[model samples]
Target: MELRSSLGSVATLALVAVIVAMLVGQQLGQPILLGFVVTGSMSPTLEPGDGFVAVPPVLADDIEEGDVVTFDARELQGGGLTTHRVVGETDEGYVTRGDANPFTDQDGDEPPVQESQIVSVALQFDGELVVIPSIGTVALALQGAFGAVIGVLSGLPGGDAVADGNVETLMVGGGVLLLLYSFAADLLGSDRGGRDRSRSRKGATRAGLVLAVILLLILVPATASMVIPSGVNEITVVSSESPSSNPTTIERGGSQTVTYNISNSGVFPQVAIIEPASTGVEVAETTHWIWRGQSAGTTATIHAPDETGVYYRSISERQYLGLLPLSVIVALHAVHPVVAIAAIDLVIAVVVTVVFALAVGFQPLRFRDTGRDTSVVDTVRRTVRKWL
Candidate 1:
């Protein structure tokens, strides 16, 4: 019975962790481990409220035709992330189409989907999608509840200050509170009448589960902070003989410097690197260290073509938490931004795991047997009343 109960607890915790990941992924607009469709574009295969396991591009094998991928769509649904099946390969990119659609995306305004734009691939087994029915519906309902709570909190006295903070920050705070409440409820409801119960109750598994939850609470927000704000910044420039005061207007055959503000609104200090993404743009300073809730600026020089014309240029920024040395992060980022993120996450997980293991070795946390007769529900009610 004890072994079965322990297994049950572990399974419950795992389910909760997956649900939390899905919720965070939705809020971050990235498929952390799962992705879902809001429309019936993939109906019959994956219904509108269904979700599927998403393997990040970094971890997944090479993309191939017939694979369902989630990519940054250039035209479909007004240019956002879209999930569709790869139908054909071209020199330019891959042709994609919704499973239920009669025509490929290229038949419309959307161009071929590039490999770089693909974020995740839906996991499949035996050529069938691993679907989680109605998970998206549950996630959407929870998100709506979060928004409602934020609205209510914003209306309270001095609550606007709290409500105005980053949504991810609020989410982390709420998650912590929820965890604490769950622990409290579990503690209050546990039966403590029999001495045999105390002898049989082994808490090593529970302790490990708690530690896992704590680690996730740390990792999810840290990853989001680095990812949510980092992306390409596109700037338009008009090169002409008569240059205006606008920094974007450059004299033909000359150069203009524009300032790009880098801000860290998260709770942790961050190190950011900005690099030129186009030929005409060059960053004056590629790296910056920013304290939490602070901002910094970097300059990018844009050279106008000899022939007067309007042009577009871009710069990309990648950031990581200031947990590791600047030089190490820079070296890892040189390989790929995702590499740096993965390394940082790995380090954090290792350090936290070691600390937890040292602090709470595998042992049963036995409670004293009090000779009082009380129903579990009554005990919980009494505990709640005392807190109130």
Candidate 2:
């Protein structure tokens, strides 16, 4: 029972902290993701119960050999948090090993994970491990109870898959319940007592400001920098054939016919137009095409030159037909990482700021007077604070 109360206290504290952090993220104009570790691979570095901060997967491959990282380690037999050192890379794939392990991991019989397998990398500071050893096990037990609730809801007489927005609704409702607990903590667990109410309020205010700064600068920026770009990433179009064309010594207006297939696998509505990038290359007049919109799948003709020995724009690959639209043929376009992430982060920051302002404006009143409480309040307050 003491453990349960402690767990509840920890959870309530973490929740309020996270929400406050998220609010700070919006003020600084960034995305915020509060993530917890579920694995013990990092051990003393990050106990299983502790929460770690993560920046998205953008420059994760850029993570150096010794950096601690959190990535989509699902293919390594199980999924969830994995903190490991990037050991080496062969033509096949990267090799990774945990910090405390005696030996490097043998590839788990699965194919060498491609670069896309990574999710995000977490950078933890010196000492934030607050969850007791394997405290998450108890948290998971609570989560398991919640899972049972979901299963019960799902199989009820006229129920649907807990997917009909009940999950989020329940979460918010649960948060509302927790919010009362948080206020109760503030009212009762004042490290500084009634004798020093002014000091407690002052400390709380300062702590709030510091938490705001950390959320805005570090946490929000990192999460926004990752998630917002993901939408844009989904809208890429690659030529089925390698988008690369060799430098050609060719004459103007001389036709060099190259055969290529244009695949628009992205969600955006775009049609491939074979435009001439060089003075020597010409757009083939025969190559006019209309894709039936983004999802209908359209194939376009790209011409390569024959003279001054024309370079044909032929990019074809039958081998990558399985992925549907995202082919091995990559187009060359230069966008700096800083500029790209900044653009999306700016947009997300705007949305987050608006919502957060509303939440602040409508911040709920913490408590209300129930008319019949004065006599009981002093007695219980004295009892609770142990002030005889």
Best by TM-score: 1
Off by over 4 Å in 1: 43-47, 57-67, 71-81, 86-96, 102-119, 124-196, 200-220, 234-257, 261-269, 276-314, 334-339, 346-388
lDDT of 2 by residue, 251-333 (tens): 33332343334444433322232333222223343122223332222233333333222122322111111111221111211
Candidate 1 has a TM-score of: 0.63
User: In model 2, how large is the Cα lDDT of residue 227?
Assistant: 38
lDDT of 1 at 308: 82
Best by lDDT: 1
lDDT of 2: 0.42
- The true-versus-predicted C-alpha distance at residue 92 of model 1, in Å, is 8.6
lDDT of each: 0.78, 0.42
